[model samples]
Target: MPTPTKTGKRTSGLPAKTRLQWSGLSLAIALFLFPIILPISGLDGPQSRMLGIFLAAICLWVTEAIPLTATAVGVIFLEVVLISDAAIVPVGADATSAKVYFASLANPVLILFLGGFMIADGAAKYGLDKNLAALLLRPFGGSARLTLLGLMSITALLSAFMSNTATTAAMFAVVSPILKALPTRRARAGVALAIPVAANLGGIATPVGSPPNAIAIGALAEKQIYLTFAGWIALSLPIVLVLLLFSWGVLSTVALPVGTQLELEMKVDFDRSRAAIWFYLITALTIALWLTESLHGVASTIVGFFPVVAFLATQVMDGEDLKKISWPVLWLVAGGIALGVGVGATELDKWLLGSINWQSFSVLWLLLLLALVAVGMSNVISNSASANLLVPLTLGLGASISVDQGTVAVVIAIACSLAMCLPISTPPNAIAYATGTITNRAMLLMGLVVGILGIILLAFVMPFYWYGVGLLPVN
Candidate 1:
């Protein structure tokens, strides 16, 4: 219906090729009709209907039939319009139960990320990320391997408390030029690929590091299983440190040919402007508050907004800066939260969870199974969607199994965070793919290996590390 572009290509077309379209549409239709035509899989009318909706949501999310946010919104609309009476309605009648879906728009996890987006946008706009990256990368001066490690370290350190996607983009901006200055493309690939992986790994270190972590916390909070900011750092920081080192080797050896090295250079113009100084001070204060949240009993979600207040009050970030906030990402997270809410309200999650035979598997085995499924699902769909779909069900399953639900919650979060195999897997992977330095084959192969390694580490190492952090009972 639209005119062709000046370049002679159609401006509007199907989002995917015909084959993909056929496959996706067929799958989506099949899922929609599945519950009606077949056995209910032992589910009742409401549970069967919920399963159909869940499958439809998964199909839409996976197929690119529409935008993910649209799919999420459609889920809420369908719930309210056609299936309201089936929802929990613990607080109100069928008509008002729709409020449950809308309530997630203001979910605490969404608020934290909303505030985080503003801070990250300000940091990027003011060149705070660059200034900081220059300082950190300069110390390794001249050794490509060390510089690569340094870049990953800084990226991980920042992502531990910030947005992984923002951190990956910022780090790529800072490091791409240095990599380009090298003799060949092979050398550039080393740090380019490693930065995103590190960003992903770093996000596991703190609750605020990644959305999945926040989702896990929010779901567990319903059951009174709490994990402090410090507690999360204790549980995940070691794994992050190991992954950073291991992934650096993989990029340097497997992704890039051995003997590839760059004389990396990081130069700083050293901006000491009032705004820059304020940026540094407020950022530091924010990190301190997030890290020490337990001591003050202030929720991190409450502390997250401090940056918005500090930056605006000091005029470090102006109205224009506010315009760049990741509003779409907030919407996306909100939609995912709302989907989780819908699952809870329908009791679909509880019914499925209760149906599982939990007595057969030990706690460690249960942890591994959940992690595997989370990682697998995240690879195919958006990680936030993966978390929303799985965490509530996982929490219910964990409690039913009589295991420490908090421990299972952490494992699931880590598994979701490590899904980096494809561009569709996570925002960081997509950002790295945009660099044009890595190939689909390279990313898929390397990401698969790294994802496996991370899962293995999580399975074997988490129990001991968790025990040390007091999140797990001594075996």
Candidate 2:
């Protein structure tokens, strides 16, 4: 480490981290200019340039060359500067190109996440998360397998409605006391691994569960295909449940002697304040509204504001509390939305889908293709970014394939969540890794086994599940 001089300023040339950032940034810029400098076949004009921008954005996002939100901001800048024809001359408010690029800022999908963050923040504020976890889990007692599964199940339940990272962080806090009370490393690893693993699995169960699921829903709705909140959960819950059980088994092997009885006092005493009670009521109300959206003809976006307003009113969260919400995440989601919009506006989505030759492909082949593309990319890139990059492409195929967009969307989003092999794959994985408890080799072995099972299972079950749900045709 460089030390400060007497003048209180360190004299350093450049750090390795800074150099890496510069290198990644330089490579991203080069990739951005690649299409413009040397035009490709079939990508001759604006599409080529825009494709360059997309690829560069994807590169920077995956590499962490700069802040992901800043990369998104850069994308907006490029879109307006290079492609915003409406900005050159006003088109009399008929939805300008510049406006299209930035439309995601006001996207309802993002609003849903905003409300979720507020609820999560409020839950943390009043210790409701710990109390809820303790009450639900205390029944398991000392039965090790049940305890392990119970921990994962509760973690998953919370993740089904909130951010997985937040859920995992909160769950880990609840479990740290348990981990210390456990005698063996094996016992600790079992519960420790379960937290993040469960978070990833639960995240795919609903639109509000994860950014990728939300991305799938938003992209599908753009094509006139929509799913009620319950509709999405019904389609995905089976997958989450099965994967959770399978992961528990895999983790049990690594966590040998998992049968070892645990004796931690799972009871947590947190008296419910009025703020906490209001938080629960508002959160429940918001979820109910989302589930019954089709019945009442209420869009989830309109219902999303319920918690945001109610939380502040009850003093569960004040105005300053809004700043605690993850603004970068909002920016990141907005960027994905903007990218999806650009892909459609430039007809690039159509062109890519048109090239797929859907008639020549069977459903199995298409499913495999999507799984490979999504899972392979997600292992290296963040799952949200993976979904953002691919969901738009998949959405474009609904017309060409004559298939139900809802079915395809569910399968693809789940596939993205199967990327659990690396620490950098997701926020939950990173959190688990930072604990210094589980080794990378352990994560790699266990995660790959679970990930492969998830992919194979998703491929087989999705067609039958959707057909039964009446979303896909029974061919």
Candidate 3:
């Protein structure tokens, strides 16, 4: 018989993960009960209850004791039971209707994201993503530095439309041959690092580019500040381009030798089938409509449903494709929306802001604080969750301080996407780390520099630019 061997790492006791879950869950529960069991000084009953929900949400989202979506839905459920009109213990007759909480699932922003998801998934299903990558990279030539630039540019462009995680995965597949042909592991690591960094930066360019953007938009809509698709691109695309080029420079200096050559090859085949043709047309038209929202005056959310109708009507994307959409992301965004509604309706923001002296805090310093907090939290938690927690608070601050609601929301959203310090920072980073081509130390080094640069740009440089361009409230 084989001898039983003893491993030093927790062979008999509860697993580490299970223990973490229980601890996190316990902390969340205690937070939820704190506001209710011991009332605060100035907050009323509804405000106190909503405060508990918000606190608990922060704990649950940061710890991820439950799935992110589960925590999201749990927030909505708690709002309905504790603060809404359907509350088991009524606060007052002014409680919001339960339907208001439920409406978050079908919020207009989620509809817009649904449309984006369909187009992105359809691109993957029809091979448009890879073909586009191949077509676009042809212009960059065969030098290692130029090839790196091309790879990042294409990845960023794709990520602007598709999800960042999906964009990173697709781009990696397209560039795997190049990665393998590199003579040094440093070159390979540099090439690999570019994809995720670019994807993370690219996600700030448009409203549907990532979950944080959508969350920011949804929160802004509640405050009567709307941003069109084209408007968002106009606001953020410059930042994306600058960051992309900066990251490329960092990677090139660190990884590629002065005169290295790279061989590049890609095969592009367009689908000419009837369904594919219709999908292609619909995709183009939908994008055109989104970009021209200023001219047509149709809300982006209304235009968002165009593809849903066109694709299904033309049989371009069937039921299976519909089922494959990133529903969890949509639900997560919805939860954020619901949380915003509950907080606003219950006057929780007013209570939270009441304690702070906004008269002494300059708008620049306040914006700086929000951006820094967003970057730090996002590096350790989900970007969307960080944005979900921060955007609404920033919106509330607009009324109390001399800040532009739209500018602050956009700042927090962009900062959330800027975090990429670890394997767990974002899905794109995790994907790159999983490939075994890049080490954690390398990612930390690169991600830290990029994140700090981004924060500096956001706090000092971008605000001045926005002010010059009339994007911010001129003092």
Whose lDDT is greatest here?
Answer: 3
For each candidate in turn, the TM-score is 0.86, 0.90, 0.95
lDDT of each: 0.75, 0.78, 0.90
- Clash pairs of candidate 2? none
Query: After TM-score superposition, what is the CA distance of residue 435 in candidate 1 from its true location, in Å?
Result: 3.5
Could you arrange the candidates by lDDT from highest to lowest?
3, 2, 1
With a 3 Å backbone cut-off (N, CA, C), the pairs that clash in candidate 3 are none
lDDT tens per residue, model 2, 214-303: 788777766667777777887888888988988888776657474577655776877577767777778888888988987998888778
Tens-place lDDT per residue, model 3, 329-406, is 999999999999998998888888878898798777777788889999999999989988988766878778777888
Candidate 3 has an lDDT of: 0.90
Compose the digit string of candidate 1's lDDT tens values, residues 132-166. Answer: 88788877765667777788889998887678888
